[model samples]
Target chain A: MKQEEKVDFRLNREYCKACGICTALCPKKAISADDEGKPSMINEEACIMCRLCELRCPDFAIRIGRMQ
Target chain B: MEQHVFDRLMRDDKLPHMWCRGCGNGIVLQSIIRAIDRTGIDQDKAVIVSGVGCSSRANNYTDFCGLHTTHGRPIAFATGVKMANPELQVIVVTGDGDSTSIGGNHFIQAARRNIDLTVVVFNNSNYGMTGGQYSPTTPVGAFTRTSVYGNIEPAFDVCRLAEGSGATYVARSTTYHVQSLIKYIASGITHKGFSVIDAMCDCPTLFGRINGLGDGAKMIAAWPEKTVSIEKAGTLSADELEEKVIIGEFVNSSRRSEYTEKYARIIEEAQRERADLK
Candidate 1:
């Protein structure tokens, strides 16, 4: 549990169905919505990289990441 | 169809595979790639292990490390690969006959031991690659080349089998539900223990001709409209279900320690016992 630990999320947009499951499950509240109600990252700095968002997203849309 | 991810996931260079047109294996392959790309697992670090069957040929199309092993033995090979290098992300792709019929014993052991490997079974019910043999998952009374008069045996419910055998992560998805397949595949990859995705794909060459599905499209369309959530699915009667083929994750729990964790604990205890002797 180092402060500098990094996690990676590789989002494949083609697979994403725009389900908000990830947005609702993100522990850090890092996921936000766009004009079309699609989930987007509003605050990457606050992310703890727990991956709950990635795991919960029914579409496999969002990938949580600490490193690009 | 000609201008989608399917094209990219497929080996157009190797087009005209033995499989008939509209075979669900193609879509399942695409979903597998999407999940791999989505996880960002280094392709070099990823290994695709497969057995002898139509679906097993998938290892050839993927650019990552691949293993085409003996019949019904992909799990054995996959287990070795994962244990040898726990860092390597290992995946096993097998057909219904290769996985459930012949490799049934290994399947149960892997689930009970909870090896850290992802197992994707191409459950088309009939063994297309091997002349339409009825497999372990073929519905009872389903006709096949061998079973001209419907099979007398009941098919195994793969998700339920895994759940019963102690798999840490178990799910069932079909080619018709592309998004759900990808989602389940991704979750299976991230899960720390043995994960099985029983992918129900179309096999027009065999299952179609025998079941009178006519072709692959109608066969794939035969998949249920809505897959029940694992929690709610248990309550409904199998006959009452629409889209008779259900698709969803049945289990995802990290409570039971994976093989690696258990081995580590054993080693630690051994070291403590040795030290006490000193």
Candidate 2:
């Protein structure tokens, strides 16, 4: 099996307001909405590390990181 | 040539600064240098004035005539530099507290006068240095060291403030978006009148720790997306607002001539009148 790249996503559920700002700004659509309209990761491979999703979140709940 | 400029401007011994890993201030600093390079502005003719803060350390790194002035007083110093030597292109590099808090009055007054200087406010939304205290740009209900639970005060809209203050050119960008930030800084450098460039930086030490974001990279990623320019802000509806924060050129106009130009013209006219009288 090929080694999967580690996706650096720092999600603070308590701070997350489920506003979807991250999902909207994400160019790759790597983020999707969960049943409760809260953002979730349905796909991680498409994340381009643009930091747009991270920078725009008002709540400061979602954080994207680099591989170690 | 680019490599030589970079080598001259940077101190290799300062290889590692105190800013957290992936901090945006460094990125903004690089962009500022690139803008300075693009303009081919004479290094000797360029002066960088910075206020005391984490971001202000940029003064030490750049090769230009740099001054790390008192806290929140970079604009005042820059103003003096320009007034004394109108030929030099003065740039003010300041932080949230340095630009919008203690130095806010100077900021407005400078713009009102249409001074020939570029003001780059590193808006990390907190006082990263001397502990993470609540700053003027900290969003309402956001966490801060002072606001243990959440920040209650509203944040300052920098672009709007600059535009309202009669700044000739106003722009906003985040460190995560490097390309946009470079363009904005470059444009501000070229602008004759007061130009304000708000570079949203990451305060991982104070802001990130309190807000639950790990460090610089995570905090930077938390930046909200930009939807539209400030010029088109009124035309957009609530539904069209994609990003929580709006970034880009907010205003660009040549309504009033710069302070230097007006002063020179006035002096010249007065001299001609005196000669005619004689």
Candidate 3:
């Protein structure tokens, strides 16, 4: 949960259909949906790189990787 | 330099795809690409063949050797391609209507032949491109344009059909389980003989609208609750599992010889006989 911890993520907002699967399944509560239903990482520090969001995004809009 | 995955894999010119918002085709497409990347397949040697339908459009967006073939004939087309060049990795992307309805014969025949081809059927339950008509895999009692009174016919379990038809590898996954889909797809591609990945996708526009289901995203979000893992599915009775989608790898067999391999053996024997006569 360090502030400097590197948790790289990329979301193709254009492809996102705002299904909220990632937000619902994220164990760390790292992803959340906006009013429009589009998802964004709300807590990068909480993301233990579990990749639930990246794996469960039905639109293939999210990609999570560790910053090298 | 490590290139961005999508940049290296997708056709940039075809930026925005034609699928409707919330359709699971994009998810399945990405899963296939990720599988290919994970397996380290040579892109130059990979060929993607697709039949007519929303799923077939995947060939148009992928940066690989692609063939958009006639409706319900991708399996047949892919069979020939694999036979001609056994070295190339051939993958067929097809819809439920294209694969199991109009192309049903080819599907079973390909599996029976044990051809070395990876067939990915995007089962959105209805024909999305031509309006929401019930397809071969559409569940009974589901509403569709053609099934106004409800789809009375029992749906085919695509994985079970493939397994019965002699496919070497058979697996099922939904758009909700992207990781499992990718893993199964990669395993299917690596399997020697015919491999079938039945990927359940959500057609929010056609299937969802006609069935009174919500939009694309909602339909996809509902999958986890609607489907059960194959292992867990066994614990449920037939009545209990009636409406639930079963997801898992149903078969993986290395015993059967691939069509191309069998053909090669025949050719070798013929050559030896000719040499003996000479």
Candidate 4:
């Protein structure tokens, strides 16, 4: 059986002010907002790891890791 | 464990900063650190100087030789530091109020001198630290604590001011455009002469709340609507571009001699003349 591909996303929720910039700039539509407007991974399988969300995050809340 | 770029540059002991949630200062700070990392500059040779204001607090988070000077005096202090040690990379971080309100003269004079210093002006359009008072860069008709009836004073386009004052490099960008902002900042740092980056940041807590601009997320989302690229702005008429923030490099004069180089040359010539007389 093939192993499932996985990527890690570290979010510092304390720092995140729910700016949604990452969600808006993500080309793969992999990030979405939760009920509190904070960002969350909606489709990790589709993530391209472009790091756009990580770079554009105003609060330094998001970090993208390599796929495994 | 792989450390984040900021983690290596920032003073981890000061983790969890005091800036309000959703403030764009963090974005600007990240861009600066990223620029420094990309330039491969020696951290030991870098000096971060900031003036009194919310933006000035950035020096507290960075691990470099940081100096939090008097209000609106970062440029003057940075200039002295650059002159004393031309080998050091002096970067000035200041707020709209600190840069344009009280430090306006120093800002223009530094540009006029063409000193080798990189200045990043965090322009949130109001005095964020002081309760959202309208600043010199505040757009006309913007509501603020002091401008309850709407601001009547015209705003100063920081890029134009720097260019007019003879800065060798000048650029503008907002927090929303992270890539361009980082690129411009890196270019500014690499530039040999006076470089100015007028970064339009969002002061969500004070400016947004008072202006009805919603939360930090909404304010950033609306940045695209308020800003126009320099290339696109060129094609638009004055009326069409009203109230739009222009983002792009306005000047880059690598041919101009930097202040320290010129001064050093004068000193060298004087010493040679004295030696000949001896």
- Model 2 has an lDDT value of 0.79
Q: Can you tell me the CAPRI class of model 4?
A: medium
* lDDT tens readout by residue for model 3, B61-94: 8999999999999998998898889999999999
Interface RMSD of each: 11.4, 11.4, 2.8, 2.0
What is the per-residue lDDT of model 4 for residues B1-278, given as tens digits with 9 covering 90 to 100?
A: 76678788988677677888778898899899999988889999999999999899998999899999999999999999998899999999999889888999999999999999999999999998888899999999889999999999999988998899999999999888888999999999999999999998899888899889987777987888989999999999999998788898889888788999999999999999999999
Give candidate 1 regions above 4 Å deviation: A1-68, B1-16, B225-235, B238-243, B268-278
Would you estimate the TM-scores of all the predictions?
A: 0.74, 0.76, 0.93, 0.94
Docking outcome class, model 2: incorrect
TM-score of 1: 0.74
Candidate 3 CA-lDDT value: 0.87
Q: Which stretches of candidate 3 lie over 4 Å from their true place?
A: A13-21, A35-37, A56-60
**Deviation from native of the Cα of residue B110 in model 4, angstroms:** 0.6
Which is better, 1 or 2, measured by lDDT? 2
lDDT of 4: 0.89
lDDT of 1 by residue, B101-205 (tens): 789999999999998999999888888887898888888888998888999988888888888998999988877666788889989998999999999887777
Superposed Cα deviation of residue B265, candidate 1 (Å) = 3.8
Chain B superposition TM-score per model: 0.89, 0.91, 0.98, 0.98
- Candidate 1: which docking quality band? incorrect
- What is candidate 2's lDDT per residue for A1-68, written digit by digit as tens? 12445677777676555545467557789888677656777677787777666545444356575645
Cα-based lDDT at residue B111, candidate 1: 95
User: Model 4: how far is B163 from its true place, Å?
Assistant: 0.4
Best by lDDT: 4
Top-scoring candidate (DockQ): 4
Candidate 4, residue B41: how far the Cα is off, in Å: 0.5
Clashing pairs in 4: none
Worst 10 residues of 2 chain B by lDDT: B1-10
